[model samples]
Target: MLQSRRRLRSRIFVSFALFGLALTSLFAAATIYMRARLEDQLINNTLQREVENFVQFKQAHPEPDAPWKLSTFDAQIYSARKFANVPFAWQRYGTGVYDIRDFDENGKLRPYKLAVYKDDRYWAFLRLDVSTQRLSERQLITALGFAVLIFAGLSMLIGRWLSSRVMSPVSDLARRLRSLRRTGQFEPLAPNFADDEVGELAAALDDYAQRLTELVQRDREFNADVSHELRTPLAVIATTTELLLNAPDLSDKMRDRLKRMERASRQSTELIEALLLLSRAERSGPIDGETTDIARVCADVIDANRPHLGGRPVEVSLRVESPLAVNAPSSVVAVALNNLIGNAIKYTPQGEVVVRVQDGRVLVEDTGPGIKAEDAEKLFQRGVRGEGAVGKGAGLGLAIVRRLCELYGWGVGLRPREGGGAVATLDFQPRR
Candidate 1:
């Protein structure tokens, strides 16, 4: 099964951070928009009212000008006969506020808002300078930018806090699971958590672990029972074969048959022991101050599998370029070598099967119909056979060999040989 590289806690934290940033950005933008809109409306309404009031005041006292009294604004009145006195830019506009920039008498640029109201006989203009308002707008923008930064920072801190709180139970569960793997103990997981999603997950894992523990226990007991029951009859056969071989009246052919029986019994016993170790997923180490002779085991396996040739002109040879001994059980070594040599013998029709032991590895090279490089690895899988496999077989021999090698921390692989054959290599780690 595949899993995510990123942790759930990290994803949650990032989601919260991004949401905070987006929310703050949106809020800041809306604030700026509303402030600008309301300011514009207020300024326009105040200017319009003032300009109208000035017109009404003029109309009420029509003798001397009410007062050329304008504090924040410059007011001007133009009669219909004095239309030319109105600024050409102001002459075209009617009865509304207009923002205008122009060169004044001092040859300097002046920006202002103009409020204009007109009738058939008179025109009223009110001008208000806006430099201070521009400065205020820039200040407001700067302030909002800082506010966005402050809130975004606060959001990040809050996200980290929430993630820690949310993931604490999950972290505890993981630590407990690691302890279980290291110590091989089972413990309930759900009771420590609240009634939440994490608690439900813990309950599910507890149930699965219990079922798996039971299944493994039963499998181990069955393997032990089978090994004990089968070893007794095999031990009897070995003893009987030795007794029958020692009889003085035994014929040469009868003695050879008894010797074959003894060899078969020994092979079966070794196979049983090796398989028991495999079933328990236990590695069988070498005895104290002793190591398994790889060359000797290869020779014995080659002799045992010669019968598989079925009278074909196949030559099986062993060459020890450099003697190798491994710190592992002889039976496991023997079982792994047997499959490699046996497969070579079965596949080679009329060629040579060379078993070479050197450099803490065994190389079985066979000159038969070679397998494709891609198909070599598949041959080690259970129930998988080569394209031109001969005779009846379950295709499990190589798979078992692979399992044994894996248990013992050894490496096994196959590749296409240069001279149209397959080369199987079983490399063992060097003993310390």
Candidate 2:
């Protein structure tokens, strides 16, 4: 549809230009013809009048060398006719009877003839010459050429402007589609006038994007639910394996073997769950859930991780001052916050870990060696490192938090703390 629109616009522009050129050519030809016809008629009328006047003048004077002041029209016309090879002749043979014959130098009949009568007898004859009106033709053609040039220029400008106006929306749509192809996203449909074809295209693209977003969202939900469902069985297997390792009758060698097996089982279970959550987060669309207090969620997370941070001399501070709330599932929010606090506790050995609420966001900060620039970007990926400074970690803590944030439709990011260590934040849009 878009390509067709562009082609249509291009054709319109070309057609307009061609129409203008045709119009100009027609007008130029008409102008030239009219000018030449008018000039010919004027010159013919002037020549006839000049010939009649000269005959009358000669009859009144009756002498070839007679001196008479000629009128402006007579002087101009006669001089031009003379230079163009007009002919004159006179003959007298009887009383008061004289015959005159006028012919061109090449014996060609002239365009004009005149006879002078004196004493009831013809005494002299005159014939005026004719020449092609090349000068008049050239002037008319030049004027017509100028007019056509102006018209063609104006037509080109108008055509280009109108074409761009019609095609601009199509260009924008093409750019958007290209961008989507590159990034694997079809979002942010542009608005256009309903009366235009571009509007129809925009509406269609918007609909397609909406359907795609919904399908992706469904997949994300399915993955998240699958991860949660798998956790229970994994927990059972891990617990059973631990029991076998702790059997009293078993030999030391058998016990050691069982312990390794138990450890491996636990790790595998966590890894699987983490992988599922990561898949969910990467695929999910915007989150839609109940409005829950984010501050309260942060407080619960801090409390849950307190036992793990107990032995260390690390100080923990929490400031959930405002009525911070978010539009998200409470369970997902809880899970996200728990992972955040747990990561902070695991990384910080002796310094403070603070949970604060401000500007409608929940921030968990820990004092430890900050994440390296190289690792920071991948910190939220599945099975990626959550706590860079912490030596013993499965690197799924931040991954879980990232997935939960996606499910809840909140923005999450990691940044270096002002003093030291790193701060993970969940910036949520407040419920109205």
Say what the RMSD of model 2 is: 14.3
What's the lDDT for residue 345 in model 1? Answer: 83
In Å, residue 353's CA in model 2 sits off its true spot by: 1.4
Lowest-sum lDDT 10-residue window in model 2: 72-81
| Consecutive 10-residue window with the lowest summed lDDT within model 1 | 1-10
C-alpha lDDT values of all predictions: 0.82, 0.65
Error of 2 at 341 (Å): 1.9
lDDT of 2 by residue, 1-432 (tens): 233434444557676777678766777677767787768876776677667867888899898899764322111122332433323232232223323233544786433223333334223333223323334556667876786787678778767776676666678778878988899856755453333566677788788888888998898888767777887777787788778866779998887666656645544554564456466444322256447777776765676567677599899888866677665555566667777787788778898988988877888888977776566669888667654545676677776766665565667888887778988877775343
Clashing pairs in 2: none
Query: lDDT of model 1 at residue 68?
Result: 44
TM-score of 2: 0.47
Q: TM-scores of all models?
A: 0.77, 0.47
Q: What residue runs in model 2 are displaced by over 4 Å at the alpha carbon?
A: 1-146, 153-290, 306-312, 315-317, 371-413, 429-432
Best by lDDT: 1
lDDT of 1 by residue, 1-432 (tens): 112334555656676777678767777686778578758866776677668867777888787845645434788999978999998989999999998886654787877899999999999999987755765677667867776787678777777776775577788889888999999878898776666666778899999998998999999899989998999999999999998988899999898778778878878998999889988888868778589899989988887777668799988999999989888888888888888888778888888999998887999999989899889889999999998886788999889988998887788989988978889989897244
